[model samples]
Each structure stands twice: as structure tokens, then as C-alpha cells.
Target: MRRRRFVAAVLAGAGGTAALPNTAGSAAARPDSPARHATGHWQPRAPLPVGRGEVGTAALAGRLFVVGGTVQEGEASPLWASTAVHSYDPRRDRWSVHAPLPKPLTHVGVAASGGRLYAFGGFTDAVHLNPQPDAYAYDPRQDHWHRLPDMPTALGSIAVAAVHGRLHLIGGRDSHRIVTPHGSPVSLGFGTVSAHHVYEPGTDTYRQAPPLPGEARDHAGTAVLASRIHVVGGRVEDVGDNLTRHDVFDTRTQRWLRAAPLPAARSAGAAVVMNGCVIYAGGECRPGSSTDTFDDVTLYDPHLDRWKNLTALPGSRHGFGAAHLNGQAYFAGGSPTCGGGTSTDTFTLSLHH
Candidate 1:
């Protein structure tokens, strides 16, 4: 009966996870992730209270928080690992269940400077084996969540961004993941990292930068225009490979540049910017195929650096929880099909171009 209601909503810890699969080759120069049309005006809100994937998203003020992930998998998988915490309030199109997360994580590295909400390092259960350097700090006006200061090593699929006010933790997959052979789930190899850190929340500190260019990635997706910090599309060297390779980073010349790739080639999607362009919505375009996710949505015109394939994600899924607030571009929970399935389906994108 629907995987027994996804194992009773994953053993009643409720609030999800599951949708891991990537590894695809043969499409060469990108651009082939399912394709449809019209997502150009987007607007369909109020849905997430459940249905999750490698979730982790942030945005303060106008609300849009959703953390941890893994709703369920197979082979006696046991709901993977989820520690729910939801929020969404685009001017009353509500959804709430906040305060949760001091444990259970899944490829975590969320961000929301100044107004609090920061939880880094993840994977405390399988799916790449344990790797958690606990770091938390949420305080939506005293809804509470503390514990910061951990993360000098021990990471998980990171790629968080906040810039200027600190909080830039690029590249990911450290402390090991992806080791198959003999017990073979069939992933010949693993381990990826290029370590780049910069936390600094008024002194919880972390400082190390400049080291991701030769190759090393994990669910990559980042955004912050002009002032630099792009890093797009991920999964390179055996996860089934996926990288159109477009890196930027330039917090005043910490250096690293090259853009205009990705006509199709995505990984762990949802790198927002909204209104002014530069987006990469709904991930996992190809890479060892997770039974087929990637419902396309690519647009980037950072003044013509080009890339366009607007709309497609009313279906096809992956570990969802993209960000951008106030002006739109929110895409909560995830997994419509592919690797695993989960969804609370909340969508909103307002860019009338």
C-alpha cells in the first residue's frame, strides 16, 4: 500500500528524505533533461508539510525554511534519516512546523545569515556513510535551536552561499562516501572535496578558501550574481558524472572564473537568483540515472553569459528545497520519481520575462 505509506511517513519521525541516484553518460555537451515548456510565470503555493528529498533550504524575513531529508528508500532502508522542520509564508500562503534539527541530516549545509538559521554538515546515516560536523543556530524570534562551532573537517555535499557577510562554504563530499565493490550497489568509487570555507557568524569562525578547480564536487548549485560566487552543476568523476563546469567566485579577487555552461547538465538542483535571472531549478539531469528525475528549468542571462530552457518540473524530481524569497522562486520538498519518491509539492516562481 504505497510502500506502506512510505513506512508510515518514515517511522513517524515524519518530514522526509530519499531520492538519491546520479550517474549518467552519453549526451555529451549537455541539454537533455526531460523538457516541456511554460514555467515562465509560476505560482502554485501552500503544499509542503511533508514529502521530502535531500532537503535543506533557507531564506529569512519572508519565510521559506525546510531542512534535513531522506523520507524513505528500499532494501529494508528504514526512512533513511529525516528530522523535519518546515516553514513557508509567502504573504499568507502558509505552512508551518518549525523547530526540529539538532540531529538527523542528509547532505546538509543550509544558510540564512543575520536573521539566524544556519545548519551545516550532514549525512548522519548511510547514503554515503556517516559524515557530520554538527553546526546549528536557528532562532526565528526564539523558536530556538543552538550549537554552533564544529566543521573544520567532516562535510557533506555542501555549496552554501551568503557572501559579503560571510558564510561561503563551497565544494563538498569529504570524510568519505561512494565506496562500492563486493557488497556492490555498483558505484565503483567515491570521495570528493575541494574544501573552501568561510563561516564567521560574528565569531563562531571558520576560514579557509581557494581550493576547488582541479575537480571535486557534490550536489553543486550556488548563486550570487555580479559580486561573484556562481559554482553550478555537479557530480563529476563517478556518480555517473554531471558537470557543465561553470565556476566564478570573486569575493574581491579570491579568484576563480568561468561561466556560460549548462544548457543541460545539472546536479542536486535549485541555485536561485530569481527576478534578475541566473537559476538552475530542479536537479539531477543525468548521472547514473536515479530512475529519471531532472524535470528541467535553466535560465541564466547574467547579462548574456547565456543559457536558456525555461520550465519543466511539475513532475520529474530529485532532493528538493530551493531558495529565494519575497520576490518568488521557492520550490519546497522534492522527489517526484527517480531513485526514490517523496513530495509535498509547493511551487512558486514569479519572473514575467
Candidate 2:
């Protein structure tokens, strides 16, 4: 009896695999099959309250926190900048709403450091243009939000991560205007940016890092492992007005290195580190197609410097979010298609082999 209790406790703390109640409609992670690499199969988890895309998510104290997104369907494009923060307690198989964000913002990127949550660069007040550089920090312990110094450049659709006790902000979109040597009716073509920014929490200051090899915005995925940061798969440049390429940046050396291109060029995807592999999942491919989100999942081994096509995601979606917890990757919410709206599905992929 004692041994059984200990095992149950261990599983519960490790994401409550066995404690997951057997319910007809509930999603549960399935044991690995022989054909499928022992990476556990995706189990359905609690769905988000609403379908959304361009959302932000971070992990704190072993709990997953997701916030900010948009619901643009029909004539009403409800800007979802709600301060409503949701906390998922896998141990209890439940989600509880914490204090809302100080302000509602969407298309923002979120990261966690020093036991606090920080959000930066998102759209607010119906401005889909460029995101405001405004920043906010949330204290789960105090159930409150506090403002932080704004970013030097206003940006949205950026990738953020906490590395070496500092917050690293990678490539993002900013307003660009053409300045031709001589004005022409057609001016020059638009040029995207690959600006990389870094923030120091202790000093509350921001600085410019190395630039990305290519200009990319939206749909990019990032991963930090073994003290190195990997930025992969997003739009490359205007491939007829869209860019889908892959690039990597080494924080230790402060330099950017090109990696093998993604099997498919996509945007708005999510990435996480598992078993020494960086996994990039979901997002829209190409343009002019409404909601062209894919259910594809790809894994890159930094040691081998190679990529493998993993099992496809059960459901297709993009603009969703992903995080790694106890060897499993949780992909939740976002739009099912490109131009369409968002989704509320929460799927978990167990990676064993």
C-alpha cells in the first residue's frame, strides 16, 4: 500500500498521469505504442475558455500560465487583452483564474524570471499595427501586476525567453518606412528586420544583441538548451511577401549561426526543449490562405545538428502555445486556420523515446 501511494504521488507531481480520471469526454495521455516512438501520445487536456491566436504562455513553479490573444471573427474583432490569467494545476486536473493583467494586450510575448511573470510588446486598443513596447510584470505570490520599463523599440510577434538570469528578446516586427535615394512611384521594396534585443532584470535595462541572419516576423519558434539559444522557422523575407526560414543565435558567443532549414516554412509556431532535442510545432504556411495552420511537428537535435519529422499533431492548429513539463510538451489553444479565428483545445505530447 505504501509503495502504491508513493508511486501515485510521484506520477501526480510529474503531471498526474495515473491520477487522470477516466472520463468519457476528458483527454488523457495514452501510453506509448510500439510503432510510435515511446514519446507518449498526445492526451486531451482542459480546453481554454475561448479560442485565440497570438497568445503568450510561460511556466512558473511547475504550473503553466497562459494569457493574451485575439478573437477576430465576423464583424466583431474582439481584442482579447484581458488581464485574466489562468493557472493550470495538473495535480488537481483543474484551472483557476488568477488576477487579470493590469491591462489587456495581445500578440505579446511572456517570460518568467526570479519567481515573477513579465509580458512585453503586444497590441492593445484595436491597434494591430505595431505592438506597443509597454511591459508588465505579474507576481503570482501577491496576485498583482506592476509596470516595467518599456522596450527601446516597439515590436510585436517577438520570441522571448529567460536565460542566465536575464530576459532575452529575439527577432520581432517593427514599423518600417522606405527612404529611397530619389522618390519613385514604386519606391523600393519593403525590408523586414532581424533585430535582437536583450534585457537585464537586475538593472532593468535593455541592450541590442546580434542581428538575426534574416528578417522574420510572426510564426517563429525559439528554444534555449545547454546554455545556447536556438531560433528556428519563421518567415525568411518576402518570398512573394512572406518569409519562412530557420536561424539560430548563440547567447554565449553573441553570434548568429544558420541551421538546416525547416522541412516546411511556417509562422506562429511553438517550440520546446525535450530529451536534448528542440521541437517546433504548428503554425501557418504561406499566405493568401485563411487559417492555413498545420498539425506538423519537427524535432532538431543540436548535438547532431539534424532534424527529424516527428509524429504529426493529432489536431491541426496555429498561433497556439507550447511548454515542456517533465519530458512532455503541452500545446494548447490558438487558431485552427490562418485568416479564421482561434481554438480552445489543449493537447499534451508525451516524449519518451
Candidate 3:
């Protein structure tokens, strides 16, 4: 699949804060006060116990578990080499070490299903374009690990969401080797895939489903509502290009449909459904120099068929993870710089009109 590269730009103002001019148009309607947009600030909380980014996170048994990400930028040493797993207690803002993954891998796509967390495909080593098909399951109840059938294809930067008790695996890169971040000439192979599949937990089997309208990977996706999965901005090429298009799939119909585009084009961001709206935060964009990353925040409303700009991250971030804890969305552990740098910082996005 063609992956879109997130634009990276240097922050010209104080403390490397990138100032983005709001795109022209009628601003997204304020459905209610205190719903975010008016308040452009994120509340800082306890940071991730481990300092890593490009990690995968999911909610299982009411707790957030983050797994396998690199410790530095442009190098896959940390993940390609470690199998450590960490669990977070959002209620108390604390972290605890848990049973490690069977293998050390990073850039994984994670989803909660059948009372377990399913982690699939990601770049495991510092090697840029390398991909893997290894899959694993984390059972919070037992605090243990188990292996599962590998995905039909080797995929990385995949987006996984549980719809109607089934796990939907979306578009991702299919290369088995690493590539340069600058889209430089390298032997690392690249291919765009449009395959979409759904896994049935009851039978431990995956079946083909309608592919996305476009072959974009490393995009953000979430179950904004029951039985519906919404996928937003992703790269169509493996070189990390950017695309703002969004799509929603109805499991009942096994079909995909076009929806609103993100206010800002992005890829490799995190997303979640909170308080009835699909909220996505912190990913990278292009037009960036060697140093900066995108700090933009965008929200999508299926009811209004539009996107609204909200608060930006305090600093540059990409590969950050996001999930709804309580009524707000909590995002953590993303690369401050493009290729491999990671941040342990965690923040809560307070939504208000």
C-alpha cells in the first residue's frame, strides 16, 4: 500500500512551537460548551513509565497497556531488541511492569478483543522499512502472553479496531525491509496494500472484508460508535507521505464509504471515540525540516460531516498513542523527531466548544 508521509516543519516561535494558521472555512460548529476547541490546552499528567515512541496502546479490562516502541529516532535498537511490556493505571496515574511480549517488536497495531489485547505487525528493528507478521495476545487477567496465528500478510503501521466484537485490520505497508525517512534511494522494498480483514474471536479466524477506498497505512482509526469503524488520515505510500482523506466502515454491511477529511493532512497519529465524537491527536506532517514535527489536533463529527481544529500539542509529536479514559482522550509516547525519537510525556485532551 502507498503510505503517506507526515509533513515535518520546524517550529519558528518560542520553545519550538509551530504556529499553524487555521484553514479557511466556517469553523466546525460548537455542539456544546466545554467540548474542546475553545480551550486549546492539554493537561499534563504522569508520563509513561518507559521512554519510548511508535508504541501501540489499547484499553483492556478498563486499563491502558502500551507495548513495544523504539527508544531513539532513526534506530530500531530498543524494540528490535527488547520484549518488555508496560501497563498503566489511568485511574491512579501509575505504571507497572507486566509479562513481556514473546518477541521484541515495535511499531505494532493493537486492539482489545474477547477480553484480551491483540498486537499485530510493526517494524521491529531500527532497520527503516522492515516489516513483520508476528501476532500476540495479552491477557490482563492472567498477566501472561500467548501466541496467535499470524496475519495473512506481513503488515506494519496497521490500524486495528474492534467492531461488533470483531477486530478489523486496515491498510498498511507490506515491505520486509527498512527505507529511508527522506524518501531516499534505498534497496528497501516498498509496496502499497489495500487488504482489509476482520478477525472473529469466537473462532480465532480472520476473514476478508471490503478494502478501504484508498490504500493508506499508518492512519488513525477507532470505533466512533457501535458497529461502525472510522479511519482517518494516513499515508498512501510507504515513504511516509501524507493524505487527509477519511473513511468509515459498517461491519453490518461489510462495506466502506467516504467521509469528511481531516482539517490537517497527517499520518502515524493516534485516535479514539470519546463523548460521541472521533477525536484524533498528535501526529507528524510534511513541509518539515530535519528537526520539527506536527503539533496539530483535529476532530471529526459524522453528524455534521466536517472536521474542526482544536488545541495543538505543546510540542512536536508523532507515533503517540491515544485512548479514551473516563470522558477525555489520553495520548502518550510519540516520537518528537521523525524517524525514531520517543517521548514518555502523556497528556489529557479536554474537549470543549
Candidate 4:
């Protein structure tokens, strides 16, 4: 199947399209306070050596790492899962290729903990038809990858966060099956899952955590704030079924609480904690006639329970990588448009601004 058709089939599912509201600039502001936006501009950085999308990203040892994802060689070329891994040193503003993944995969959840990078479950092929439970850890000092225990359930597009020295693998999609096996048809069977599992690296054990409340979704943005895990905006089953629900899990209380919803519904965005706030940037949705990528950057103030706008991306992108290192947030290697387009552009916004 063609790249566009494959993406359409994966995102549209059966045969229906759902329209999303345009809420990019509709964040609710306090009546007593003026509308607020973060002060800064996205500045260009070193581009990726190879363009890709749906990559897993995390910061480890003062450097940002971009892991496995889908790669498209050209406009007409077929998309395939990639094993390429690259690390960027913001201090030097340079990118260096590191040891690649053991296998090609996309939509893998990545997190940094214990001086190492961990990769969670993801799709093993070009199409989002195969979900795997495999897990691995990367050590930058050794430039190697070590296989870890598999997750309890197979998943892709999961939200991963490291809190209290444990890795939390949150809601994702599973139970994938090809509906049309012949003739370049676009059809697939899959559903969102609310399975939540926590992994302890020290003991190499897994424990079941509370499943995500309200909705079972995938491609949600996640960040750790004051030991609380915040999961925001994702699709229920397909990109058209975007959601604005925000759920927070407090490590101390071991309970889930509803937080302020995202101003705009999105999926496949990057989330990071910066300046004591959760910053979500660059997601994709099928809101109108075509697949639309986002450049709208929004910041959530957990203390105030409010959201405000932030500096927009240099270009719209989705299925990309975002990590915070030093005092800046870095975004890299995502589709500039939507579907299967690829880009090598990298941009950064300072948290100190």
C-alpha cells in the first residue's frame, strides 16, 4: 500500500471521519487576568541526519536521544520501520548517530531513568498493524542496547513517564489485525487500551497500576511534575477521535485525578516539564478536509490549573521527538505535514526566556 493510504487506513480505521474543533487559540483565561503567552521564539538547531516520524525521544546524561521510528526515503517511496538512533548535544549544537535499535519499530515509548534510556512497546512494521511487548535499555557510555523483560501487554503509541525511580507505561492501542490483506486496500482492526504497568529497573519486575480512567487512548502526551504523572490529549482509536481529557496520577497518593483538559485536542505530540510547567507541542489531527499537523505550543500550569500559549514551532509537525536538556526544550525529526512526510529540521525554545 502507498504511504498515504496506509496512514489513512491506520488513522481513519473502518470507514468514517470525525471533525475536531479548532481550539488552538481558545484557551480559557482568568477573567481577572489578561491572556498570557510564553515569551520566546523557536530557534533552529542541528537537523537530524535522517528524516523520520513517530520516533521515541528522551534525555539521558545531558544529551537528547531520538530512537526508532518510520522512515520514508522519498515522496514516492514506501515507508518502513527504522532502527536508527541519534543523540544530540545541545552544548555543542551537534548530532551524532549512536547504536541503533535491535529491531525496527515505531511509536515506541521512551524514558530516561537511572542514567540509561529505556524503550517500551511499539509497532514493528511500517503500517501500525503489529504491536510488540518487547522492551530494551540503552547505555550511552557503552553505546549498546540491552534487552529487558517484555511488557505485560502488547502496545504502541503509549505514554511513558519516569517518576519515583520507576517507569510508567500508560494507555495505548493493541489487538491489531489486518482487515484487508490484498490489493492495496486500507483497512485495519485495532482498539485503544487502558492497561497501565510500572517497571522497576532495580529489581527487574513489573506491577499492574491503575488503568487510565475515563478513556482508553493512545499517542497521549506525558510529563512528570512534582512526582505526578500527567497524561494529556490523545486519540481514542483513530486520529479523528481526538480527545482533550487530561489525567494526572500522583505518586504519593497512588490515585488518579482529573486535571485541566488541553485547549486543543491533539495526538502524537511531545510533552516535557519545563519551568515548572508541562509544555505540549507539535501534534496531528484530521480536523477538516485533510490531515492537519500542529505548530501550536501550549503550556499548562499545574499549580494554577490553567493553560496558556507558548512559542509556536518553526513549522508544523507530528510523530516527532521532544526532550528537555539544560535550559531548553528540543524537537527533532517529524513529518512537516501529516501522514508520511519526513523532515530533518530541529528547533529549540529556551525555558529561561
User: Candidate 3 residues 1-353, lDDT tens each?
Assistant: 12334332311111211112123323344444233344445888787766777788887776777887775433334444346677667788887889987877777888887789888887655533567888788888898889888889887778888876778888777764345545654344355466788778778788988776654455455555677778888766532466776777767766666777787667777887776677777666555453456787776655556667777887778877877777667787887866556777888787665
Clashing pairs in 4: none
Q: What value does the lDDT take at residue 131 in candidate 2?
A: 59
lDDT of 2 at 304: 46
Give each model's whole-structure lDDT.
0.70, 0.65, 0.69, 0.79
Candidate 2 vs 3: which has more lDDT: 3
Local accuracy of candidate 4 as per-residue lDDT tens digits, 120-153? 9888764566888989999889999999999998
Candidate 3 regions with alpha-carbon error over 4 angstroms: 1-41, 72-81, 176-189, 219-223, 238-240, 288-290
TM-score of 2: 0.79
lDDT of 1: 0.70
Question: Candidate 1: deviation at residue 159, Å?
Answer: 2.7
Candidates 2 and 4 compared: the better one by TM-score is 4
Better candidate by TM-score, 3 or 4: 4
What is the C-alpha lDDT profile of model 2 across 1-353, one tens digit per residue? 00000000001011111111122221223232221243446788887765556778887877778877775444565555555577676666567777887767776888888999888887663324445788888898888888889998777767887888888887665635333333332222222346677888888899987666544454478788766777777653222333345566657766566666677767678888777668888777444454356788887755445567777887777777887776677777777666336676787787656
Task: Name the lDDT of candidate 3.
Answer: 0.69
**Which candidate would rank higher by lDDT, 3 or 4?**
4
